[model samples]
Target chain A: MGNAFKEESTELAKKTAPADLMIVAKGLTKKYDDFTAVDGIDFQVKRGESFGLLGPNGAGKSTTMKMIGATSLRTGGELTILGKDPNKQGPEIRAHLGVVPQTDNHDNDLKAWENLYIYGRYFGLGRKFLKKKVEELLDFAQLQDKRDVKVDQLSGGMKRRLTIARGLVNEPEILMLDEPTTGLDPQARHILWDRLFRLKEEGVTLVITTHYMDEAEQLCDRLIVMDKGKIMAEGAPADLIKKYSSKEVLEVRFGSSKNAEAAEKLKHLGDRIETLPDRILFYAEDGEKVLKQIHKLGFEPATSLVRRSSLEDVFLRLTGRTLVE
Target chain B: MSLINASIDSAIAIAERRSGKFGAEFYAGRTNAILERAFLAFKTSSWMIVLSGFVEPVFYLLSFGFGLGALIGGVTDGAGNSVSYAAYIAPALLATSAMNGAIYDSTWNVFFKMHFGKLYQTMLATSLGTLDVALGEIGWALLRGLAYAMGFMVIMAPLGLIPSWWGILAIPGAVLVAFGFASIGMGITSYLKNFQQMNWVNFFMLPMFLFSGTFYPLSIYPDWLRMIIEALPLWQAIQLERDLTLGTVGWSTLAHVAYFAVMIVGGLYFTTKRLSALFLR
Candidate 1:
C-alpha cells in the first residue's frame, strides 16, 4: 500500500504536463422525476484530446454534456471538470470551460457584437480586452460585416458561429459542444468542422456529442457509443471498429423490408448482418469476399455497395440500429 | 503528501466547493446583460419609454385630477380628513404606477426573455449566475419606475397636488415599492410556463389597483375588507405617500415604510433563489 501510495504521489507530481486529464466523471447520473436521463456512467477526457459521445437523440448525450458544463446538476455520483466539482465549483470550473448548447439562445435584444461584448464581460474580462477580443472573434466567426445586426436577423449558421465565438471569449481550456452541427447545412457543417479543427490544433480539449457517425469518424480521436443512457462501447475510433466490427461492410438494398429479409438469408456468408426498414448490411472481414458469397447464394439484391467498416458499423453492431434518425 | 501536492489538492477542493459562485455570477451577469439590452431597446424605441414614463402618467394626472375630480368633489380618507378626490387618488396612482411599471418590466419582460427570447440560457454559458440576472432585471425595473415616478412627481408638483417638500420623498419610496413587486413578480414568473397564466397576474393586479384605495379610500370598505387592504404592500405604500404629500405624517408612516422594505428584501431573496434554480438547471 505504501509503495502504491508513493507511485500515485509521483504521478500526481507530474500533473503540470500539459496533457493531464481535464475531466473525470465517476458514475455520474441525472434523474428527472422517475425517468433516468443519464444513468450512472464514468469517463475521463485528457487534455488536448477530441472526445465524443456518439449516440442517438434520446441516448442522454446532451444530459451528460450539460452535467459537465455545469448547466445541469447531477442526481448521483461524482463529476469533476478542470479539477473542480461541477456542483460546488461550477463558476470557477465554467470560467475555464466553453459550452455551445444545442439551440441558438443568443441575445436577440442586443447587436451581434454587443452580445459578444456583454458575454465577455460576464466572464470578468475587462471592457478594453473584451472590445479587442470581440473584434477578433467577429472576424474569426466571419461576422465582421454583421456586427451591428441583431441576432434575430442572422442566419442559423451565422448564429451558430457566433455562439461558438461567444464560448471562446473566455479562452476556456475545455470546450463542450452539444450537437454543434445538428441543424446546419453541409456547407455550414464543413465550415464549423474546419473551425473546430483549428481549436483542436490549438490544444483545446473538445467534448462533443453527436449522432452523426461521419462527424465522429472525422473529428473524434476517441469516442463512446451510447444507447438508452448507457455506454455500449468506448475507445479510439479505429480501435473500437477493430474490436467490435469487421474490416468492411457490404450494403444490400432491395424493394422493401421483406426483400431485405431475403438478403438476410445470405447472412451466413459474413460475420454479422443488420436488417433495416429498406436495406440490409453485411459485416465481414472483406466486403468483396462477402459480395461474392452473396452472388453465389443466388440472391440478387436491387443494389449492392462495398465499403470500409466505419463507426456506423460499430454503432450497429453494438446497438442493433443506425445512428441517424 | 508533498507541499506542492497538498496545495494543488487544496486548490481543487476549494474550486469544487466554490462552484455555486459560477452559477451565481452567471445569473448576475445575465441580469446586467438584460439591463444593457433594455437600455439598447430603450434607445431604439425611445417612443415607448416616453409614452410609458411621461405621457401616460401626465395623462392620468390631468384626466383624473382635473376631469374626474370635478364631479366627485372632496372625499374623506381613513384619517378623517377631507381632501380633493384627485389629491387622494394621485398618491395612490403614484404608488400603483410604480407597481405597474415594476410588475410589467419584471413579469412581461422577464417572461418573454425566459421563454421566447431564451436570453438567460445564453447568459448561463458565461460566468453570470441566476441571482445576478434577477437583481440586474429588478434594478432596471426600479430604474423605469424611478423615471415614471420623476415624471409623475413633476406633474404633481406643478398642479399643487403635492402639499409639502416631504412629498418628494415618495419618489424613492415609489421605487422601493416597485422593486419589491418586481422581485416578487420575477419569482412568480419562474413557475409560469406560458402566457396563459399571465392573465391571472393581470386579474389580481387590476383589482388591487382599483380597490387598494387608488381611486378611493380603503375606509369606505367594511372592517374585514379594509383590514385586508391595509395588509397589502401597495396599500401601505399609497397610504404612506398620501400622508407624506398631505403633510399628515405619523408613526404609522414608519410601519408602511417597514412593510415595503421587508417586501423588497424578502422578495429579492426568494426571487434570486428561484431564478437561480430555474436558469442554472
Candidate 2:
C-alpha cells in the first residue's frame, strides 16, 4: 500500500518538475496593529514529508499556521500552497488541503456521521460519494459504533478523532494539524500519534505545529524552532540534538540553598553547567563519568539522575529557554 | 440514492462553473450546499421553537385584529377606501410576522453560531467563501419568513380578512420583507460582541413593530411623527401588502416595492462585506 501511494505521488510529480515542493514561503510576516505576531520567516515543505513548527505559547506558531491555511492573509511576504497564491486563490487552495484546527469545532447539533457527511458536502462532494466516504472514515477513526451518537456525547479523544476524520472527507493532498495532541491523556496521545503515523506512511504530506518537544521529536521529520516570531534553528530532531546539546546530561538536586553552591564547585567537571532554584544541570559526553568526577571532587549530591540529550536540550541551547513553561 | 447523487453532482458542477466565471476568492457559488446543511440540522431542532414563531402572529390577529377591531368599526387605508379594522391590521400583522421570523434567525441564531458555535469559522475554512456563508444563512432565514407569512395567510383567509384574490401576491411581498430584514440583521449581528449588545436588536424592533402603522394608520399621528414611522422598513412592507390585499394597486405600490428592492440589495452588500471583514481577514 505504501509503495502504491508513493508511485501515485511520483506520477503526479512528473507533471511539474518542482511540483514535489507542496508549500513555499519567503520572508513571511503577519502583523495585528502595532504587534508583529510573525516576524519575517522562511520555510518550505515537500510532498510526502512531515514538517513541524515548534515553539512555546504566543511564539506565533498558530499565526503562521493560519496564514498557510489560507484563512488569514499575511501582512507581508509571499506564500504559495500547491503553486497557488493563498490571498488570491484561497478557495482553490483550501479545496485541496485539509485542516484540523487546535480546538475541536465539530457541530454539536449533528451526529458523528453527519459531521463528516456535512463537511464533505461543503467541498461539493455528492451525497453518494460522501455516504461511502463517511463510513470509511468512521472505521479509520475507530468510531464506527459511535456513528449515531451526538458529538457532545463523545469523549475528548473520540471528538479529536472525529475532527481529524472530517478533515479527510475531501481527500486533500496535504493535511495540516495545529496542536493535534495538546490536551489528550498519555494513552490517548499515543493512539492519535499512531493514527497520524499511518497517514505519513501512506504518503500524505503533513504540516504540524506544536509546543511539546516530545511530540515534535516523535512526529516531525524536520522542524523549525520558533521564538518570538523568529526561526531559531531548523533540522531533524536527532541532528538538532547532536549539534546543540551534549551526548548526555546529569541532573542533581541538593535542596534550594545548596544548589547554587554546588553548581559553582562542579563548573569545571562537565562541558557546561546550569544552576536553577533547586537543581543543577551538567552537560557532558558521558553522564556517569561526570557523576564520578563530581564525587572525586568531594561533592556529595542529595539526589541525582542521568539521561540522554533530547530536543528539549536543543531548544534550551538555542533560545535560552525551555519549550514548555 | 443514485438519482439523488446525480442531481447533487449536476448542482455542484453548475456552482463550480459559476465560480470559475466570477473568480474563486469571494464566491464559490455553493450557497445551496450551506442551505442543505441547515436543513439537516433542522431535522433534529426542537419543533416548539418553530411552532411558536407561527403562533405569535395568530395570537396578535385574535386579540388586536378581532377583539380590538370589534370596538373600532372601520379604518381608512392608503387608497382612501374604508376597510374593516380587522382587515386593515391583518396585512400589517402579516408584514410583521415576516420581519419577526427573519430577525429571529439572523440575529439570535447567527449570534450563537458566530460566538458560541464557531460555525462560520469552520465553514470559511473549507472551499466555501464569505459570500456563500452570508447568502446561505440569509436564505434559510428568508425561508422561515416565507413559512410564517403563509401560515398567517391561511388563518387570515378563513377569517375573511383577505377580501380580494389579489391577497395571494402578499405572500411574495412578505418574502421580500424577510429577505430585506434577514440580510441586514445578519450583517448587524457580526458587529455585536455579546448577548447584552444583541438585546438592543429586540429593543429597536419592538418600537418599530408598534409604531409602523400596525395598530392604526400613520395619518393619526402628527405630520413629523408620521414621516418618521413611514421611513421605517416595516411601514413600507405594510404599505405594499395593504395595497395588494385591498385591491388598491397603483403607482405607490410600485414605490413600496422599490423600497424593499433597495433593502434587499443594500443588506446583501453589507452582509457580504462584514462577513469577509470578520472571518476572512
**Model 2: how far residue A236 lies from native, Å:** 1.0
Candidate lDDT scores, in order, read 0.80, 0.86
Query: For this target, which candidate reaches the highest TM-score against the unseen true structure?
Result: 2
Assess chain B of each prediction and give its TM-score. Answer: 0.85, 0.93
Clashing pairs for predicted structure model 2, backbone only: none
Query: Candidate 2: lDDT over CA atoms?
Result: 0.86
> What is the per-residue lDDT of model 2 for residues B32-96, given as tens digits with 9 covering 90 to 100?
88999899899999999999999998898889988999999899877688889899998998898
Model 2 regions more than 4 Å off: A1-17, B1-20
